[model samples]
Target chain A: MARVNNWQLGREMSYWYPEERPNKQFAAVFDINKCIACQTCTLACKTTWTSGKGQEYMLWNNVETKPYGFYPLSWDLKLLEMLDGQEWSEDGGRYEGRTIFESAPAGERVLGWRPEDEDYSYPNVGEDDCAGQVDGGASIQMPHMAWFYYLARICNHCTYPACLSACPRGSIYKRPEDGIVLVDQGRCRGYQECVRGCPYKKVFYNAMTGTSEKCIGCFPKIEQGLQPQCFVNCIGKIRLAGWISKPGEERPDNPIDYLVRIKKIALPLFPQFGLEPNVYYIPPIHVPTSFTRQMFGPGVDAAIEAYKAAGAEGDDDLTGLLGLFGSTEEVLARWKRSGDTITGYNDKGEEAVSVPLREPVSIRPSYDKLYQITRVNCP
Target chain B: MKKTIPKIVLLAFAILVAYASCGGRTVSLSEVVVVPDQQITLDPTDGAWYAHPYHPAKLILQDMVEPRLLEPSTVEVEVTAMTDGKQIAFRLEWVDDSQNDLPGPQAFIDGCAIQLPTEESVSIPAPQMGEEHKAVDIAFWRADWQAIVDGRADEITSIYPNATVDHYPFDAESLKKDPDAKRRMEQRYAPARRLGNNRSGPRKVPVEDLRAEGPGTLSPAKTVSTGKGVRTEKGWSVVISRPVPGFLSKEKSSNIAFAIWQGANRETGARKMRTGWIPLVIRGAENE
Candidate 1:
């Protein structure tokens, strides 16, 4: 074991491999407050990469309602039970608990479990299921009748991937150029240790191929300077694909670094697990702290407060960056706010997306001069 | 006698490891005799196997030293080998409560393998997958592979009987209706087969020839071996047939090893029950 720094944990933790970060890391952010759970991203990913045999059940990207939903039944609840007393030293500071690697069984690399075939049968078992209770005829207010939020998920492409460490054959690899984790089809003997080791249950076994496979992070598109299919086709505009930097190496102009580091409006999901997950989520503002804190770590209440200030409290930089989500097909590398408009640039310093802090509304004239047609319903 | 294997999975390495002497454990010679029986057949259920006496080879944890082992489901295997001077065949039997023939992500396959030194020498390499430059040739027999070769498991439907499927676009209806659809589907979906991952490929023979230099260096050899497995009332009885090892080809007396993995216990590579080099002496004509 090697002692490596996990910025999310605010301390060094035990990891199988020595700390060797890539030059650039693939990352994304999901706005839970904006997601409507249409599953367009899921189907887009399915048709693009996983339409082949043995891939019928794989959804590289999925949206599940939090507190009662999981792709493979209780993927989180089981590990949470195993970890037991998970707590943080402060509200948004150091995590004072065991990570999956620290709490792993003796001789095991990670704290994980393999799901049965039946567990993956229901991809959306608890779709839109409510959690908290409410009395009859509850008023429509901030604390809603029942709390539920859409959580979009994908491979975190962790800095210290559990799947990579569990393979006895060393078949799984994390690409140093893009930090994308992949399975070497040739070297893998189909032991399925990667399947049993990933805490998020993202890696899947292809029974037909008899090898494990996982999200490629769409490196092909990334290399071509375009966003992933799911990120580009998200109809809800609740997702953004970009590069993330370390805590001290925070780039204020990078959209991901700006939201995750500068403004701290977006926090990693289950940071206590300590994989240094790249994908960040903006917790829903209305959810109870008791539930959200454990899911997103001690940063939940603070992140939600900062997220609220993005729009209602007039934080222009944050309000501008949130508007850049799903704004273009190009992967955003650098972003900046100019007065009322937010402009995002690609890696090559070319302008990609420019959006206003608030959308503009226009009403047509009651009568047209050229066509001579009168509007039926005029305000 | 009611056989009850102690649930304590603490495998004492000094007793069973080939290099235990290097670790300050005194070595005691354990031998299993291999006689020259002309009527040896590669049929595990041959009733002829009852004629020869079974040699008990107690198993130890493979690769990992003690305190590192979680549990080993298989404790021992009964071995009996016969040779016609040209080829060698050995029958391995063990007791298992569950017969695991399908190797899915959640399920593993029951298997047994016999390993032999590639060269003839008095000193043998480390028994835990051998050391670098000291290659050990191995022949492995898997229940799942045997099931496929026996026409028991044919395709995806065979592994997962109740798996509901709408359709796979690559698996065109025209192709499924073809006479050799199984071969074609095996070619398409099973990428391992296409890339020549002999471990996961469609099995023409029940056993594959493999060579290993170290723990993670197991690869397919250039030769072919044959085997058969039959799930009995107690467990599995498997017969593996292959050319005599170079060490055994030159000398009548040589050393060999045995390893078995219990799928139900989630055992596989580097996590198996194995034995150290057990001395084998072929019986002479005078003795026969």
Candidate 2:
């Protein structure tokens, strides 16, 4: 029998006990289908917070078109190629599980590829090289069918953030109270240790101050009884911000509930990395289930079913899903209750949800005092 | 006959001797002029002496003589000149608290010249040897420029009675790098670090005050008019103020994407900055 590592279990799990938890575990849920990729949120955030010097290269918020999308130039594919390896499965899929090879035969790998390789390549439309030509009535070279969806992303403020673990200096910490992750500006030495460790690569160094900065989750506004600026400012009304449960509470019968728990439109981004990211997404309905499962997790089917069942009996359309799960109160309640297990009942009276709770974790942010010099005239 | 001649000669010689003695030159030896060494004594009772108006002369001496020895051969001397003129120089040599030779006090002249002044009263150069004596005579020198100005060099010289050399001993290497000395100089002369006139701390001026036509600068009635091109939740509708002219062309649009973020409390009417960006693409207009 495998030895039960209760300590390890304790190290990995976190729960939202309504009476004990500090502020609800607030999160923003986004439906990929509704996102128009306008980048208004990026500009809004840029003008508000990141317009300062040292933040020139920073996008605390960004939206990238997927299938061939990434910032820092192909960051995702490059990291993926590095972590996994050259062999495609004989079964015609890009990956089987997660096996990374040390080295492969010359033809087996895409040779001479690098992360910095695309600095001069124009892969995306409207980029530097292709800008005015689009307006000059140029013929379309790429078909529209190859177009992919865009995902606007920021710090998820994860339940088990890999960024927190990668910091050797203990500068990264999460608030046990609100579950917001932050880097202590004073303690951070701009080591880039956390940057290398985080699978998401959200931690960034500010060139001006020589320290790492990341999303603060809009905690100050949240504390003042307001939703996050990102959630509140979503022009598409596609983002919802509220609390989630510790996996064992009563579930709601709303659209958000259907998307998160029932229909599972809103599923965790990548659970196998095991960081347990809090920001969930509603699976793109047009995508294949295999791809969806790979993007979300093994449990995408159950979540989708839960979403379909939340609406009135006769409705089968997307609007019904939106109508049933869109309300904040029911969705928030269901999230608060769904901790270690799914919190709603089904017609069969069996366990209807699978919300996994493993261990409790915390992140504490710190600050440094800096001196400024000013000139004065004597009297 | 011989006896009679001898008697006549003796009588003549005796008469000549008596005449010479009676007419002797009446000379008296010049009264032996004794200056009595000009009995110089430093008037300890003087107000100036008690007030220490004159800089104290410090003698830095090296202890070459052992106490157990009957007599020591050599002593190294370092003299620090502290007085601001008005003082003279003198050296008193003695052996075992006994005076051997005392040089008369000399006044400093000619702008405290480095070379010793050679007069009946002369100022000796620093580190000069005293009158040689056995049993190692200790010497004391006074080169007070101030005493020389006061014409009290005679009195200042008397302070040393059976004088013993005093040394200002220190590690030359350590003094060269004295941290405390550096700190003292810095404290006395360096400038202090301070913030602005409002030294309490850095003041954060409101963001609106920093920008022209911002919230703080606008009148309440004009608030709605100032934020025109910029989108706010309540006063605006989603309009393509500027459209990408040929968005559908093969060439990429300079503005290929449009992103939106909603303001919090859009209904109740609070003007706050948006938090996050959600990307949107332009599909052909519904009318088109």
Candidate 3:
């Protein structure tokens, strides 16, 4: 094992291979507060990529009602239990406890579990159940009927992917150009070790073809200077796709860096896993910090507070940049907020999208002289 | 070097057993020699099996080695050999409480493999799958692969029994109008098979010819082997047939090894019980 620096954990951790980072890492930021569990992204991914024989159960993108929902049964709960109470540095920047790689059992590469067939049976396992305040069985009052927030998930394309390291034949690899993790179909032998090693459980086994496949991060689209299908088809306009830089190399013009590094309003899911996941989420403000802190790590309080401030008209730059989420099909390589307009640029530094921060509201008079009729409700 | 002494003593004893067996005398060689016959058969139920002896090869746990299993499940594998003048076949049987012929992410299939050095030399490579510059030929058989070759559909419905599917694009009725689209969908769905990964499914045979110069170097070989496995009351009995090994020389003496995986015990790649180099005494028409 070699010591590789995991900026997420703020420490060097042991990994099977030495440190070799990609040139440009694919990253995304999901605004949980804006998601409405529409599942448009899920269907978009299914039809575009996973509409296959053995991939019938694959949901490369899924929006689960968090606090109770999980894609593969209790994926997080089981791994968290295995870690046995993770303890980070007092400031939450440095991880004090063992990571999945550190706590691996003897003769194993990574500490992981393979979900049973039944686990993938339910893509949205706990969606129907009342999540937030159903404990006391309160009356049907309109207090907070929407207790849970939707967490839209896809492959994070981590820097130190466990799947890449767990594969005995070295079939899984990380792209040197864009940092996209992929399973080489020519080399994979259906060992399912990659399936067990992925913390997010993104890798799936295909019974028909007898090899493992995973979310390619929509590389075909990524190669053509377009955003992924899931990111482009988000109905809630909650996802932004872009390239993230290494620590100490953050650029202000980059939308992903602006949200994840500059504003510190976006945090990775389970940073303690030591994968250095590229996908980031702006924590939900309504959810308890106690719960969000454990899921998103110590950055929950800061992220939630910053996100709440953006909505309260305190952070215009942050709010305006979010308006560029679903504004274009092209990946937002660079972004800028000038006056009332938010402009996003494509990889070639060409303008791809420009949207106003606040859309104009229109009203009609109660009486329509031209039509010789009076409106019923409008005034 | 002290460990070589036991191997040398075993080699000497194996030579004595071969001489005794060749003399047409009834001798119970200690799992060391197999007298050949022209009418060798692969069927475990065949009377020809009784003509040969099932030598008990004790299995050792693959533990403490880098990329090794934590525990062993199979204790021993009963082995016997035969030849049909052109090719050789080895029959292996082991006791497993359950028959695990299904393949899933969590499922492992009952399987066995035989390894023979590609070259007959004074110094043998490491028994734990040869070393660099020293290669071994492997004949691997999987019960699931056998079931597939025997007409078991390699589909999800065959394993789950109650599994349901709305529709696969490649199998959709609408795509029949567009053969190009249908072919594209089929090709897209089975990428591994399209790329010619033999270990991945849609196979025509149960046994695979594999070669490795060291651990993790295993890959498909040009030779095509064949095998069949039957579920017995106790466990499984399998026969793996391959070409006459090129290493068979006039010396009439060589080494062989065996490995077994119990699917029910979650035994698969690298997680198996194997034997060290066992003395194999052979006397074929070509060698003689």
Candidate 4:
């Protein structure tokens, strides 16, 4: 096991892959509170990619209701149960038990668990089910009818992706340019190590082709300096895309850095897994604190506080950056809002997207009232 | 009593010699003068295979250690091969205590496959389902598809009594539309298994003719081939036959391989048990 610093974990943890950071890591911060599960992002991703045979049930981008929903049906619960009783020391900031690699059974590189085909037959079997009413010591409790929130998910593209580490033939690779993880279709032998090793179950088995496939992070779009389809077509405008610089080399002007590093309002998902997932999320404030803390880490409280503070105080820079989410398809390295327009700059400080703070509004008389005047007298 | 003891001893000696001659897990492709009248069917007792010289190909089954999935509990497969002038056939059988023939929810049926090089141009493709530039053609046989071929009902409601449907859009007569409605209805209930035996048709067939250049490159071929599997009490028996026009050429030897998948073990994709390439040499008419 190799020990490496993971800012998301707030401590060094074990990983199988070496520490080779990317120049400009592609990252996103999703505001969970803003997501309405309109599924516009899901359709956008489906139409762009994953619309082939054997991929009928695949959702490269998905939004499931939290507290009772999972795409692969209990993917997280299974991993948690396998690693049950594993302890984490807050003071020491280290995990005591085995990670996906350390706990691998004899003769295995990573713990292998395969969900049955039926597990994937229905991608939205329990999209919005409610959590069981366990009133005892459970910290996060909600009223009988109104407890669930939408959780949009994609491949984390982790700093230490278990999928990449588990591939025996080295078919799965993480790019050095922007740290996008992809499966080399030509080299994969359909050995689903990446599928079995992924804790989130984002990597999928294409039975028709007899190989594994995963979220490509829209690298073609990313390479051209444009945001992913999911980010662009978000009906709720909940996603912000930019580069996440390495720790100790903080680029404060970077939109992703400002939210994840400077303000620390967006937290990486399941940091305890210790993969340093690049996607960060602003936890849903309405959900129970204990549940949010367990899902996001101990930083949940602080993250929620910082987010609320930004919105309440009208911090224009932070608010302006937030408004830039889904502002335009072009990827923004840095952005700020001035007056009625939000201007986005690329990595080289070249102007990319200049969208209005709000679209132009028009007021016209009602049809009945408009009949009283013609085009010449409409004004 | 004395005469009976001699007879038993002689029988035992003959059996031992046959086992030694065949080697532990290796079989030879024997050329046959007559292809059985009952050909192109998955029958283990077909007379053509019995009349041909047979070798016991032993199989050492193991877990897919690469991705490190579940270890295979069963350890052996019995293999035999025979070829007429027109088609080549292989029959594989193994001992499986459980008969997992239904591909139900969370259930995987038994399956096996045969792989051969598409072209004899380059070195034999990597056994790991062939790599790019070194293409290998594979014919996969699954129990679920076989059951449909055998005219067995494969509806989930029939397979699992407890599986019930409260209501479906197609069930409502008011919502029915002609021409494509029945197919759309079948798609709703039996999304993966509706085509039945016709499922093997290349363009619309469920069982596809696939070729792989390397690990991740398994792709469907433009045309489909013939293969079938059957579930037996002990395990599964399968036959995969194809016409290789120049298989018996005097000059060159051939490489062929097989893979087995136990769906009950959650074996699919890269999680399978396979054998390395086995040389197949055919005797020419001159030798005969």
Candidate 5:
């Protein structure tokens, strides 16, 4: 077994400090093997959150088909160009990865140095821009190798979010209580600093209000001990919301522990980019390792292997917890052992767990009931 | 061999350079024509209105007046003659109300010469003849004035300032007497008419009954407490025992005025205006 490095552990713990920071630190672990890409979660979030003017161009949560897939037309490529240095040729042509800044004449300078420079780089390819259907090659001879998968993504609410550091107006802030990063609309001048600063480009400018807005992480509902609208409405049952252990705190031996820790299927998205995104994903099962390494990072193989080993150990609790949408023996035992106190170490010192602090409670009924209460006008 | 090669290359280069320089062509600059600014003047025959294009002025009208006469009264027509051999024509029409065309006795004056060279004055007498008044609508147009009337050339805005219509009351009786006479006169004098208003007084009409009773009741009278502690025979009570003017009542104008004016008037020899001309008469003898 490869030794787990301190950088990865330290990076993970930074998210959990100052209160097991809620949605910002707590990531949603997606079992991509089970995700049918029905787009239920995407639609659910769209109707609840992004159904406002100026939000028309935004998809706070989106399930994009992979390979040739991107929401704002090559958003990843445009961002990569900004992040990686590019240089101008002697003949005044530009090529990527050549120089930090392009050489120009005294009066002329190449534009678009920062991420915000490519604000609309994500091309929202409308239906009009779609290529018409066409057949390629002989049907039998044409390779069936092109496989597309769905990736549901949102603000990772990162540990050291680039957006927070980039804001000059000091409008974007992470709550000390829950670590939820929020844009103060009153203070924001719409300089689009946060939008450019955020490597993920999650902060979107609302043209109607003339201010910046982002995911609020459903803080009001979370305060009532309820999951976020996105997680609660996830039809695939692929999203789980719970507090992570505080730094130095031993993780619980429950199903959440198995799903998040032991199985190791839940890996952080684009860890190589070093954002330490809170949202994690169970790597898509059959994609080639080379593609995964390029997309995710070098640790993809080991993470998958650890998950497989955990399953083979005849740990039904581990297996069941790792399975799709069913409570495993471990989950049941944890539920039965409720109120049984156990001592655990937090960052400061050891503390007794009077009850399972963070467990996956039934989010559907509460969400439906809350919907009914808040949506009194609904038929 | 090398020396010969260099000579051959130089000879080819010289031939290419000679062909390239000789192939270049020249372009001559076109003649620039500077057109002098045209001066347009609409001087009303009655001298009631004057409009000069060189010094444009605006007339403001309010909606309270009659809508027919509220329109623009007059516009002058002028254009600089261009030597491009192109004839110029000018036409003015009311933008809003197309049915009201400007009456005309349009004139083509030499703009270079401020005075009308041929005629001292061109009169477009009000549309109505002498007595029974009818409303007159008038505007001006100039073209190769001959071609415009002949319909040979289209009316162009560049040659004409914006079209304006002036409505004025005309004598209806005169129009009736010369039914065919009016048409003949219009045709005869149509070229010299200029459209504009002659009136210079305020045009707003005052509105009566500006305040109308709406759905709700009027505000109720406030019950003000006096400080004298007096209970009237009527159920209304006053608690004046505290102070003459309570804190809440200090802001009232009547209370503040009474306090200031209640003192004796030294200028009037202590004679109180409120006590009337004399003191109350007694029931005893008048002179005792």
Candidate 6:
């Protein structure tokens, strides 16, 4: 395992590249409460990237309904089942379980997993389905225990990406500039280690070229100061994309940095994996608190509380940060509220986007009895 | 004595017929396929392999749990190995129904590989591309690369004529000035063609040397090798040759393994036919 010091996981874990952090890490905050499972972001990412042959079932950005749905059909469930049980030690501030690296038996480079091609053939087999009781009676009481919420997923671009670590040929790498993990096609021999090592199963195999491919974090678009297609095309306005500074680096004006670090409303998914996934999420508040804590980490309560406070107190900075979602095509380095408008600026302090905190609205024309177009008042 | 001699002759004839029926499938033994001490071309039909014995190694379906491929090899590979003291070569002939030399967007290329452990002391590496702590050097020859060497590069139009493009950005004259303009254009517009270009070596030499420490660890080695393949009416005849320092002593033998990837059946990775370790022997001058 990679040598480590000063990590959230106190123990010396698996071997990973020594961290010489990128100037800015690609990060995202997806509000699970706001996601509607519309799959608009999925299609947007598909049309932009993974729409080629051998990529028919790959969803770079997929919103799977939690507690029931999974893109690779129980990707998380299988990992969790394999790990058996996990415990969080508050005093040590670390997880007590076998990480993917620690779990791999001898003679195997990875934790020995190979999903059948059929497993990938169905990315949304159980979409929108929830695990619960099904009663035949007229009086139904299925709501007491059953619950489902949308979990929008993309490449985490982790600080210690298992995919990058597990690639024997060193084909997968995290960019020193933006921290976006990528598979160098020229180097990849389609060993499928990235596909196996990724606990999230985001890295996929391309049988056609006999290599592995994953999200590039839209680095080309990002270089142009543009938000990724998924973030920009989000119909639910749930995704916020920005650079997150490493721990101890303070940039409160950075929307993602503030939400993820300062206010602490956004928490990383599966912190127990010990990869320090860059993508953060405001855990779904409606789900069972225990389930959310298990999935998100011990910070679930604080995150939910901070999120509620931001909306209740109408904190302009927090509201302005939330308003930045899907508001522009350009990447925003910093954001602040100015009266009714939330203005976003690039790293150079040039205004990139400005959106009204609340969109201006006018009365709609009255509809006719025929449910057809009818102008009643005025344009 | 005359009656006994006739019976002996009949018995010998029956045994020969049985061995011929099995198509020269050699038994698992310390088989030594001799290599002459003369320079020889890599042409499979160059009459050079005639001096060596054809030991057909039985290949079975790789029914590993990872891929779970159930299809069996339709024909046994008639193998003849030889070396010219400086370089070792192997000739493999298999009966393939179709010439699946082109790997398109959703296709796999028919190919074969010969695996030998880098260090003789490391015990024969795993049949499935070696294992951790046991490394093997592989010489892989793809049918697609052979087609390119044969001056017949497969195009998208060859597979599907109906699929046509109206216009491409590379058609603009400004981008054509770069030395690698055509290559850059193909890489962006045609992914399948890009893969073929990336995988294949330069024009005359098609085979490349690869090393694997374990499954999913196959990587290109710094040194490349040479291989050639010819498609006949019923099958393919492939010859893979690599330069070796010298032949091993009779006391020391190298373990050899083979894997075949059939393009028509979507066979790749762990999904291919393979043979177990065959103690490869290079005949010494005293034995010859």
Top model number, lDDT: 3
- Name the fnat for model 4: 0.17
Span of ten consecutive residues with least summed lDDT in model 5 chain B: B255-264
Candidate with better TM-score, 1 vs 4: 1
Candidate 5: TM-score, chain B only = 0.14
For candidate 6, the iRMS in Å is 6.8
Tens digit of lDDT per residue, candidate 5, span B117-202?
Answer: 01111221111110112111111111122222333222222223352223111223577676676544432211111111111011
lDDT of 6 by residue, A149-246 (tens): 88999999988888887775577888888889988877776656678778888987764455677887988898888889999888888988888887
Each model's lDDT:
0.81, 0.37, 0.82, 0.69, 0.36, 0.73
Error of 4 at A285 (Å): 2.2
In order, the first chain's TM-score in every candidate is: 0.94, 0.63, 0.93, 0.87, 0.65, 0.88
Query: Lowest-scoring 10 consecutive residues by lDDT in candidate 4 chain A?
Result: A137-146
Residue ranges of candidate 5 with Cα displaced over 4 Å = A1-6, A9-24, A81-145, A254-262, A309-313, A323-379, B1-288
Q: Write model 5 residue lDDT over A217-249, tens digit each, in one string.
A: 777765554557767666676665544443344
At residue B117, what lDDT does model 3 achieve?
Answer: 84
Model 3 interface RMSD, in angstroms? 1.7
| TM-score to true structure, per model | 0.88, 0.40, 0.91, 0.70, 0.41, 0.70
Clashing pairs in 3: none
Cα lDDT for residue B130, candidate 3: 82
lDDT of 1 by residue, A1-379 (tens): 8999999999999998899999889989999988999999998888777765567788888889887899888889988888867878856688888998888887777888899878897888888889878888777676465899888998999998989888877889988877889888877877888888888889988766668888889888999889889999999899898999865898899999988988787888889998999999998888887888888888777888888867788888888888999889999999988999999999899999899987887878778878999876554
Residue A6 Cα positional deviation in candidate 1, in Å, after optimal superposition: 0.6
Place model 2 in a CAPRI quality band.
Answer: incorrect
Looking at model 2 chain A, report the run of 10 residues with the lowest lDDT sum. A1-10
Question: What is the per-residue lDDT of model 3 for residues A208-310, given as tens digits with 9 covering 90 to 100?
Answer: 6778899899999999999999988887888999999988899999999999999989999999888999999998877767777888999888887787788
Rank order by lDDT, top first? 3, 1, 6, 4, 2, 5
Best-performing candidate as measured by TM-score: 3
Chain A of candidate 6 compared with the true chain A, TM-score? 0.88
